[model samples]
Target: MEEEKRTVRAVERALDVLLCFASRHEWGLTEIAGRVGLHKSTVHRLLATLEDKGFVTRDAATDKYRLGLSVLELSAHLFRSDDPSVVLLPEMEKLRDEISETISLYVRDRSERVRIQAVQSMQAIRRVATVGARLPLSVGASSKVLLAFANDGDRETVLADPSWPAQLDLQTFAKQLDEIVSTGYATSFEEREPGAAAVAAPIFNRSGKLVAALAVSGPSNRLTPDRMHEYAPAIIESAHRMGALLG
Candidate 1:
């Protein structure tokens, strides 16, 4: 068991190293060690293993590393597969184009919502969402929409979590969720971030299983509650199309 734990830890550290390249294209050994909070020697070992597997490539002249062809190959396979991210990205893009706001696809992961895919707005001032961001499922429009469609147990688990705001009225929140279910969309103003607002709708698979939440978000000045409500229908329509295509 101890050996297995060590192996898992090693794998996790290697993944952490790889994840550093998600924001930037390349990194030197010292920079990567600093970023991953690991020693330079340990990072070098992991980098060597990754390079051997063609997962990363090192530029000898600059002593910097970048993701290699294997990552692209895996991404290609993922896109070709029936992944929801690949299937729904087009619709998400369309919604972003129409509303001129950041569009995000989120799925509940335990008591948090994870953004798996996003199409950022082109506006000079807009909300920006990271693809792998994990946020509390207690405030944002997408969180509410997702929880509204979640099973009873999931909803209870989320509400029972201690991370929830102590001052929030659970009864009022439940009623708001019911309203969202009835209207097929939910809108929030400055619920998650101080200057961000969003509207979200649930995405259900063909079998009527809630699969994800589709959200349109932007700066509060641009996506006020009224403006978000005005765009709710378009967001809902796009989410429905994505769900249908999930088949």
Candidate 2:
């Protein structure tokens, strides 16, 4: 029993080492060990094991450690599952086909939103976002909708943090949130990423709580004010369909 517990601890430490890389582009052995609160030798051994498994890799020139391609491959496979993505895919595809723009599905994780699925548009010029990317709760249209519909305590926690990246003026953000709730959607132009514009609507479960957000993003030129207004109804319809499926 003691040995099993030790093994679990080791595995957790190894995972912690991997998670430590989340905030940085790359890190060295010493830095990783210090952040993970493990011995240098232990971290070195774990890193070696991960590298062998293609979960981490050592930079050829800098000798720093970065996430390996296998992690991305694994995440891609997970996204293709028949669970949430399967239920949402048809709706996402419908939105993509309707607007000929990229559609993304996101769910809130604690204080942030993570993109769980994306259907890239076939258009020659399009905005592209990865499947596992994380966005702050105060910036993009989807994030704002999520924030608006979140419980009061969660909303307060996210808005109270001065270090939050979006850093909108609190009073103004609060006012705009009311509009988002009233309309059941949100819109942003070149807010989070340059040259990208997006419109997002909230997905709710049978219990009438926000469960996810469906967003359509594309190049600013293509997703102009007129185009956004044109796409809003389709995006909202997709969100409603996804919410019903989830229910």
Candidate 3:
């Protein structure tokens, strides 16, 4: 029984070391040990085990540790089933075809948003975003739509964080969120990435929980504000259809 308890405690300490790397740009062994409150030797052993498993890696030059590709591979495996790519690719393709622009799907992870799927139009002039891109919730139309539709607790938590990005003034952000909630959609110009405009709407499940966002994005020169306004209805309708399917 005592041995089992010791094993569980070791596992917990190892998990603490792993989690310490989550938000860091990179960390060395001493930093990881200090953050995890473990001795250097223990942390080194844990890191070595994790590195052997491909869950972490150390830079040869910098000697800093960061998450490894194997972590991403495992995450992708888990996401493969519930991934928005699996759920919304067909709709995104259709939207891209109809609008001649890029369509993307995003989901909220705490105060951040992650693009899980995207389909770029066949047009020679197009904006490209790779899958698995992460962005702050306060930046883009898609992220804002997800934030505005999120439960009140989540909204409050994100808004209350002092470290939250402050590119947009709180008053303006608040008012925009109110409008988005009222209209069930959101729009942005040159917010997330410069020279880009986007329109986004929320997807909900049968239980009425916001699950994801569907967005159409393009170069501002071609997809002007007027064009986004014209496309808003279709994007919202598609989100509704996707919500129903998720249900």
Instruction: Give the number of the best model, judged by lDDT.
Output: 1
TM-score of each: 0.80, 0.78, 0.74
In model 3, the runs with Cα more than 4 Å from the true position are: 1-51, 56-73, 80-83
The lDDT of each candidate is: 0.90, 0.86, 0.85
Give model 1 RMSD, 1 decimal: 3.1
Q: Over all chains combined, what TM-score does candidate 3 have?
A: 0.74
lDDT of 1 by residue, 25-140 (tens): 98999999999999999999999999999999999999999999999889776655578898888888888889999999999999889999999999999888998788888889
Single out the weakest 10-residue window by summed lDDT for candidate 1.
75-84
User: Sorted by TM-score, highest first, which candidate order results?
Assistant: 1, 2, 3
Pairs of residues clashing in candidate 2: none
Clash count in backbone of candidate 1: 0
In order, how many clashes per candidate? Answer: 0, 0, 0
Name the lDDT of candidate 2: 0.86
Among all candidates shown, the one with the greatest TM-score: 1
